[model samples]
Target chain A: MSPLFTSAHEGTLAVSAGIGLLLLAASGWVSVLHRRKPGPGTRELVLRLRAWWVICALFLGAVLAGGRVGVLLFAFISYLAFKEYVSLIPFRRVDRRALFWAYLAIPVQYAFIWTGWYGMFTIFIPVYMFLIVPMRMVSLQETKGFLATVGMIHWGLMITVFCLGHAAWLFVQPLSGFPVAGAGGVVLFLVGLTEANDIAQFLWGKSLGRRKLLPGVSPGKTWAGLCGGVLTTAVLAGLLAPLLTPLPVRVAVPIGAGIGLFGFMGDVTLSALKRDLGVKDCGGILPGHGGILDRIDSLMFTAPLFLHFLRFYYA
Target chain B: MKALGQILRSLLFLAVAKPFVALVLGVDLRGRERLPKKGPALLVANHNSHLDTLVLMTLFSVRQLPGLRPVAAGDYFLRNRLLRWFSLRLVGVIPITRNHAVSGGHPLTPCLEALDRGEMLILFPEGSRGEPEARAPFKRGVAHLAKSRQEVRVVPVCLGGTGLALPRGEALFVPRVCRLVIGEAFTWTGDTTGFMSELEDRFAALEAEIAPPPFPSHPNMT
Candidate 1:
């Protein structure tokens, strides 16, 4: 590893270049729209692009800084996402202490990632928090809405902390035998592909989508879009894997396709969540993106799946 | 030396308060442009946590912080010498007497004086922090304070989720998103009742400004 980048490697630079190309393309596309009759759509597109710039800068900077910084960033994100999820649900006064413990699990989960305790990182939230949160709630001995509340808290912890923690855990993995691109590359590969899959689906859906994927859940998603998106993402993943990962072309393409499929699942799942809650956005912190959860919901599912997949086959 | 202390106090306050508010809790501001640019202004909000004052302070520029005085209960904020010093010196709080004014002085007398000095005062009409994320009926404190000071622009702020972040009883902060919706400034129209009702209506509207839109609770709607 170079002293300048510290934890960054070939894969890190590869991911950065990919993001730069994306920005260049977006900026160029937006600039050409001025010659045509511009409207509210144009303004929104510009705002969306600007937000992407900020998101990219912050993310890549964290990755480049080293694994520790990346861990902290993901920890903060899990904290924010959990905050968004729990705030939306019905929580009583009795749940305060339990809420504290649930929140404490975020740091503890990330601490495992920081210390490279893969065993605990994977099961702590799913197994331990699953039992412990309900126990704390039971200690309060509040039975009314007890089961519902306990189930909801544990589920949220799994999604926001456990699932997202996989991405941070990627940063901590030993990259000595993996590839020259290092751990940063693996983290970037997952993020870049997941994000690209989202964009590809949106574009494909808009252009060729004649049928709704889930008419009740997401009115926008279409079958045509999903197929097109997964295909594109699979191809992109195959091309980038050689530069970024230790995976063979056969493994990489399937993982890419899996990511695309799972990414869509996460998006619609959040859509269903918002629908059930009867709210549009989780939070309005991001101008165009909604909340941190909204921006990274796809990653919430994809991160855990990819991390475990790599563990089974390669790690 | 006084000016030096003011600068030092603001530096310390900003150093400690800004990050606590910004980093730990997410703040969503609405109608922020309506916040008064200059003082002799009144910032009335619904209180739930100690963070109510801190969250409001960060909305203003650093230079204006010296003159921003949060109107807090004298008995609550000034019971001890240490608290008294911290509140008075660091927070720049103008302690409002909560007890009966047996001395025949108006309860809002000190607040009136602060406004006279062109300071921006934050008043929680609820008088005290109560339950988390629950809006208590705003007392007539704001109307009472603004009654004599007709020139001061009364900016109504609806602060939500501060309680969820650091509620009254809890010492530890569980990070949660906080919302502050600043409403259009209004004035006392010589009728305390009318002003109170108007402020009440304004808060209702501001709370709705930050509140999530109503949707069917059951999943059947989709």
Candidate 2:
């Protein structure tokens, strides 16, 4: 249990090289795959690819720099995505009072994780945020769906703050003996794998996703695409385990499967929220991407569940 | 103390109306401090729907900021006895004659007097409600008031998405999300006549200049 890695075992440099190769491979594969799909216009395609490029850059940066900086980057992404969600929902003057609590939750929840207070991070949203939000609403005495309005705020916080905050908790995990399970590596694996699954699912879904997973909420999502995405992530998890976690190939597969399934569920849940709110995206902040909520919907569900599993097994 | 009470009353109305309004039309507002706390402040807003005034009032009221007395039309607010009474007292409506002198009551005088009393006035300088496709040309009233009261700062507001909920010549109040954008206050300058004319031109040109970007985090200058 050394405090740092030996010179030969350092995965930072190789991780960068691997990422470059992965990007080149992905672009090549996507080009050949979609060559005849009647894709978006050249300008639109460039813009869409640029967003994926930024996400990849963030991924590569996280793997290179572990610990607090890694966790902070993930937290920052969550906060921006959540802001995008709230902006889209049209809140009434009475509902405006809840915003103070909603905005306040972003920093406090992350602070709990930053201090290595995992217990507080877990319940901050469900318990503290839940109580404080309703109380804030009560002060406004806004009789509207006092319950429902408070519930949506809670739910939004849960998804945006609590669930997304899980990625930050990776900093607190003890990664002394792990191979692919170092704090930095795990964050990279979880984020990269989950986002990769998203990209894979979309590609697979677009190409051969004939059967709808849930036609009412999201017509594009399909069972075949889901299976394809999970399978891809599982294989990637096995290959990247030594660099990311000490769990080895055997454990990484199951974990990757969990991320893929839950990430898909997160996407569905967010879709449901949009359905109820009658909005397409949370806000038009992201081009090629609908909104912040759209981008992090998968992370919201995957991050928290991943943290819990890691904590139960390793921490 | 009076302003405080006015804000409390406005909040109370919003608190009561939240359920009915939120159930049907969603409402969201930010950057409320843009409304002046003490002194004469002009709330110039884009007139898209008939509900713009109500939504703006609800917002200013809930902030517990000073109550806004909107400058409405002589023809609309002063049409019938019941409406005139309700508009004047309940909503604090000050009727302005259509490009002409007031028939009986004071037109700009009430607004000017309100300013002197350190009250806030919501001025819709379009003269009347506009069609959805285009915002009607702004009148010179906002410029005149700003120039006459050099000490006052005029706030520009671009309201989006209220017309779909409530259209012109419609009696019912429909439900929809409305945005009240509060830009920073700017003082009226230059020669009085020219300043007023330039102000009107600038005010009308704002919608095109702003486009559809996210609301500014710190939009208010003063």
Candidate 3:
């Protein structure tokens, strides 16, 4: 295995590029099909495919950059997610003052990741911010809606900053037997499988699904979709884990199933949020994807869990 | 020389101040189509933060920035030399005395003159910053100006979230999303009392238009 590109890692990149090419071809085909028989859903599908190309390119670019750049890329994602979350929620006048502290927490949390201070990075938001955010609000002496306000801001920080920050921390993790060159591949494997599960579920549900999984929360998810997604993700994880990480194939299968299950939970959680907020999307920042929050809803669940799974087993 | 200064000021506003405020505050301008492309108009808004004026200034098109003059309080803006320079040269603020006894002149004189010159004048009819998420009653000055100059269009702009951004007494500006809801331009010839009530209603409606819905309850509770 060469230091720069092991045969296995090179194969992974080649497969990723192959997937990108296939998506491009599919987009071109859809463009032509839409020109002939245009419908709103078809038009949206074309847009989604085009957006996929851009997202893939960006993800691949950041993965290839490696080291601190990869960490900063994830940090940027967390910032956008936090912004989207803040914009959606109704904040009190006093809560607005506390939000300054909440927004400041993002960079400080990421700074922990960049510097590789695992102890502080793990506890900063859940422990320090948990105590300090309310203290800052208390000093203002506005107690109206105090508990709810603190809970909301703290929840936003946890999901958007702390949870997503774990993905960036993956780059710095010292997997006992894994080569450093394979770190990007490991990050890619988790991201790719998680996202692939989402797509597979949607496709399977549309084709063969019945009996809604959580009809009230998310009308689209179904039992058939969940089963298909979990099975497919487990198989994919088993295949890719050997190439990407030091985990044995048996360990990879359950991790894949865990990501699929948790990813669904995340999606449903956000769906419940949008349902309550009475908004279809968090914001219109991403065309066809709704918003940054909408796109990364599943990652909010998968990233942290995968990080811990790796940490407990490999670190 | 005066024209040159005006051009430089407009350039600075467009290049520096506009983007700075927009980026920092996340300013969103809605109902912009209601504003006239080129006409004499009076813009009355609710003031709660220092960002209100800057948000309003950045809303105009480059061609309209030179023609728009923000009516700032003379007591607050004219006391300091640097602020006076900023209000006059950079923002094209027309300082009006809130206390008639202090100036011994009509407070509406400069505003009327600017309107008569076919320039757009922006006014905060509340006169001063009030409690966050609340509005003080509109002063009769805006109604009187609207009544007197029936030819000039009166547009009510309701700014949401600026109060939270800088609020009344806070010196440090917090970056948050602020929205400007520009109401429809209408000619008002009604009595001052009736006009002020109507303007207040318009502000209330615009505020409701952009306000976020209440937070969602927990799933278990539901």
Candidate 4:
């Protein structure tokens, strides 16, 4: 499996180059329209966006460094994300033994992905781990609210482990035909483009955003932010296309926008769960930030969807 | 391993009790700094809502006050599996039989032992919770403990507005503002019987100091 860039696919390269510039222009436009005049918060958002841009570039550099290094980064992301998820929803003493099993799944899931054993990785949490976890809980014979207890554990694992496992799958894909260096680059591309949408929407919403989107579910979400984020994401995806897959410029733009839109839905869904639970900030470990669950809520929804798309288009 | 077990036990208690407590319950703690910073301290608090224990945990969760154990009788907390586990392991509860004969005489050994170990023990002293703002007859347990461990700092704490949250035999915990007043610690000095009487008197004074003025409609509005 050679790097996607090894193919020197000019079509993909042109798509990435074109989309990047357009996305920048769209983001600028959204900033101008919403803020009308930028305030301190708006200025901070811009700084955050710039920081993300540098991070993406650094990650891209690592992917270009080598395949093994790229895979390591994917594994690291899964580790951090899963750590954050577990910290938010800690287990009771009776259920804590199952925690070991849950932790054991992380390495196994990534290992399966490294070996390209897609079938095993997909079923690891929902199937095998599901059976084992409940049995472990029942063996104690505590027998109080058993169903609700087990269900929460299973659900938490599904989002944190199953969804996150997809990131590792990016490495096993054969990216020899792509314009970028490796399947790892495609993973980086998808993550960067998706996260960029989050930043864009947040920035736009804080500025010129007036109309609320799904006010009951997520009071802060706004239509203006959604429009701006989608535009920006699609354009960025198109520009970055040359560094990853051989998708046409037209395809990259729309696909990025679609991912961004869906990603927003994912964020809101997680937010709804927290709101229903009547919790503010999932665990409050991060000084300014909330919890691990809060940070990765978007990825929980987007990872599986993006992976399915990858398999559909390139498999 | 034993020390680690004690801490893990506390965390387990917090984890289980967390759900029972609604996030809506708000606390406006007054005189928190008055919490004794040193040894052999007795936190004598008025009981109103059952959730008072959790509120206390939240208050002291961040700070380290050695030998800080809440005395819970076997009748209420130990009757169930979950609460028993929580009370024994996490709360460091000391079971005291209510109005039962002490076969060996001197039932205050547990209290004295705790103080000797340089730990803080919380006592209800009224033996059970009372109506909000209404004072109950103080049990001789606090007086007995003070008489045995003369060095023990007797800190009286009054909790207000808890019964409104989960009054007797209620499952639903309604959110309400709860208040806590920590009275200054005082020493007990006198003959055996007189010392116990003095202890009761000091307790009454602390109660009066913390208890709010009776409403105009109060039947016994003295």
Candidate 5:
């Protein structure tokens, strides 16, 4: 149950130390490259790096703060993500009230996680909000794009609130028999690998990308990047799982591979959404990273997958 | 004491209102650096949502807010006793009666007096909230207001997505990115027709700099 600063369990602190060292190396590399000569993306790369520093530090602080704080953080993340979602898409003006109700579902979903009510947490948005969204839209009495509006509201909640809420709910799951990193360790593992996988894929594609993975969907994604990201993530999982979670190296490696695959699925799916909307980024919340949705798009898929993965096998 | 009271009231209004506006809509305000540093200026934007006034008000700081006045429809905002008090005291809105024929006084008097007092006036030149994210005909009021004060700096702001966020009739706010593109300030000429056409040109240019509204284009254009 050692998740740095929470209880000073050596494993979590060690992971934090590794992350700190990685940050140091990255900044140092960026500086050295700058010293060589000012380049095109160097400034943007530095901004992205600085943002990553803040995001990583805050994420570590929140998750380590405890289950309640983790739930609150994820809830806030869901809030921002959902806000960006509705902002990016267009809907009939009559559905504004119903959309507000959709936003309200975020806190309710997180409340279930805060109280450790998994049963309600799992079904609340998918089941309850599904019905409520349509009914509320019908009450607006606007038949024009009626079903479409309902579908947008429900789907927005599912992706932004429902899926991301799983990461928070994972924090509250009891770490009983294995004395694993408790829930905190699992969150760190899942998020850490997912983010690492994203970076690996991006860097790999940047350096050695040849064949476009999905030319129409995401031109930047390459098969080389995909294989490289999976391999890199698999290794990271094998190393991290032993320290953070109760999963053995043998099991964690394959899970890491799955994360890479599902993480890509989430990324490309949101990319498709952006394409449909004809937007480059959802919003400019983050400086170089685009929006909150742009950053957490992969986490949307990975969070739910990892949560159900644990529920199915371990928990 | 009155000056102090004004500041205190603004603080109270901001404490409650600012965060709620910020929470619902992420305003990507561009060219804010061009905001007039002092008063006797006009902030003219296209009218879209009720939230447009609130969103514009939040742009100015506490110090700048006191000298600022929103030119609103008296009939709309002053519909009730509570709204009258709040709009007068807290919002500092200069409610101009839409139909001067019925009201029997110069509709531009309040705006002209505000400018003469060296106060900044926030005017929606389209007169009222039109179709969401669509530009309506530029009402001659703002042009006439500017024509009264020759030295007034007319800053054109195009608010995209405000109509989508709250619009005219909606009570609940849908979280949307409100793009506020502020153009460089210009002075008004004496001729009302020429000034109105120029204002339209400025707004058109500012609108082009922002993201096109996701909704279909309205059949009517300014």
Candidate 6:
């Protein structure tokens, strides 16, 4: 094996390319179907497939570029997520100074990942930020809405910067027992399955979904979709485990289930956020997909959980 | 020379000010369509920070910005040579004396002249920066000008978050999301006092619309 590409890494890349080709074929089929039938959902399906092509190209390109580029890519994702999150939420003029400090944490957190400093990367945002943000707000001497303002800023940092930083750490941090060369493959596996879980749930829900899973928060999710997604993702995870990570097939089953279930929770969490804020989408950065936050809400939960799971068993 | 200056001013506004506000403050403009596309109109807004004029200037279409003149304080903006040149040439600011009683000329004369020439004029009714929560009572000059030039539509605008960006006595600007709420244009139809009160009410309603909910009292902080 080359220094950059292990057999597992190569296999994951091949699977990614295969999926991309299948998506292209699916898009072509949908375009022809739309031309013949001209249905309402056909246009949206074609648009989604087109977006998937772009997303796949970017993801594979970053993964193939090696660890430094992969980590940088996730850092950029964290920045966009933070920008969208901050812009959507209501914050006062008094909170601006504190918000500046919150924005500064992005580069510093990514720096920790680049240097491979695990301890500082974990605590820099969650702990030190928790203390410094409130203290900085105190200097303004405006007590009105101080607590609420501070809490919102801190929450934004934790979810967008801190949790996403964990995904970046996965690229650079070394596990004792696992092959270091397969880090890119592990990232590909996690992102691939997590996104696949989202698509599968949506498809199953549309076809077989009758009973509402949580109608008030996320009306589209259904019990049939949940079960179908879990089964499909678990099977895929078990299949891809050997080619992506060192985890055994039996262990991969539960890990895949964890990713699917938690990914559902993250989706609903953001749904509740949008519902409370009275916004349909966070922002309009992506076409077809609502915003960066809308697309990556599931990863926020899955990344941190998967990172810890791998560390506990494999590391 | 005048044409060259106008071109430079337009370039400065387009290339520098617009992007600066968009990137730094994340300004969200609402009811922009309410602005008249082609007409002489009086725009009155609450003053909270130095950013108010720049923000208002950015909101106008490039074609309209040339005809738009903002009424500025004679004391602050015209105090020195460089400040006076920048105010007049760059933003097309018309100086109004703070103490019209002591000053020789009528404070509303330049504003009226601008409107007479079919130009759009922006006026800060409060006349100077005030605390965000409470606006200083509007001086009678805006109402007087509106009544005299009844043909010019008087539009009330309510601005929020500029004070937080560059509050009084603070040199550095803190980036905050600002909102500019452009209100409906109404014709003047009453005494100066009545018009002043109505305008003040319009500002109050807008402030209420955008104000953040009050913070709950904490045990630690009185």
Among all candidates shown, the one with the greatest DockQ: 1
Give TM-scores of chain A for all candidates: 0.93, 0.87, 0.94, 0.76, 0.94, 0.93
Candidate 1 lDDT, A182-245, residue by residue in tens: 7777888899999999999999999999988799999999999999999999999999988778
Q: Across residues A19-126, which tens digit of lDDT does each residue of candidate 2 receive?
A: 788777767766665675645664456555667678778766665655566557766666666555554554444565576568778878777877777678777889
Please give, as one word, the docking class of candidate 3.
Answer: acceptable
Mind giving the per-residue lDDT tens digits that candidate 6 earns over A153-179?
A: 898899998987777787786767776
Cα lDDT tens digits for candidate 3, B111-204: 8888888999888888888897678878889877888788788888888878877888878666666767889888785677777778778888
Ranking by DockQ: 1, 5, 3, 6, 2, 4
Candidate 4 per-residue lDDT over residues B116-186, each given as its tens digit: 98887888776776664455777767777877777778887777656555554555443334556677787
Evaluated on chain B only, what are the TM-scores of all the candidate structures, in order?
0.92, 0.76, 0.91, 0.78, 0.90, 0.93
**How close to the true structure is residue B81 of candidate 1, measured as C-alpha lDDT?**
98
Predicted candidate 5 versus true structure: per-residue lDDT over B157-218, tens digit per residue: 88888897787766766677788888989887768888888888888888888865454321
- Name the better of 3 and 5 by DockQ: 5
CAPRI quality band, candidate 5? acceptable
How much is A1 displaced in model 3, in angstroms? 23
Tens digits of per-residue lDDT for model 5 on A1-315?
A: 323234534676778778889998999999888778777678777878888898888888775665567777888888889888887766656678888889889888887887788799989999999998888878878777776778888889999999888888777776557553456778889999999999899998999999999999999999999999989999999989987887878889999999999899999999998887778888877777988999999999998888877777777
Q: Candidate 3 versus the native: TM-score?
A: 0.81
Using lDDT as the measure, the top candidate is 1
Every candidate's lDDT: 0.83, 0.69, 0.81, 0.65, 0.83, 0.81
Q: Which candidate, 1 or 4, has the higher lDDT?
A: 1
As a whole number from 0 to 100, the lDDT of residue A224 in candidate 4 is 95
**Clashing residue pairs in candidate 3, if any?**
none
Clashing pairs in 2: A91-B27, A179-A245, A179-A246, A180-A244, A180-A245, A180-A246, A181-A245, A181-A246, B25-B176
lDDT of 2 by residue, B1-222 (tens): 656645555665676555444433545444567766655788888787767777777654344334467888878778899888667655777776775543555458778988887777887777767685247767677777887898888888777657645666655443334555566678887576776566555555555443333332211101
lDDT of 3: 0.81
* Best of the candidates, TM-score: 1
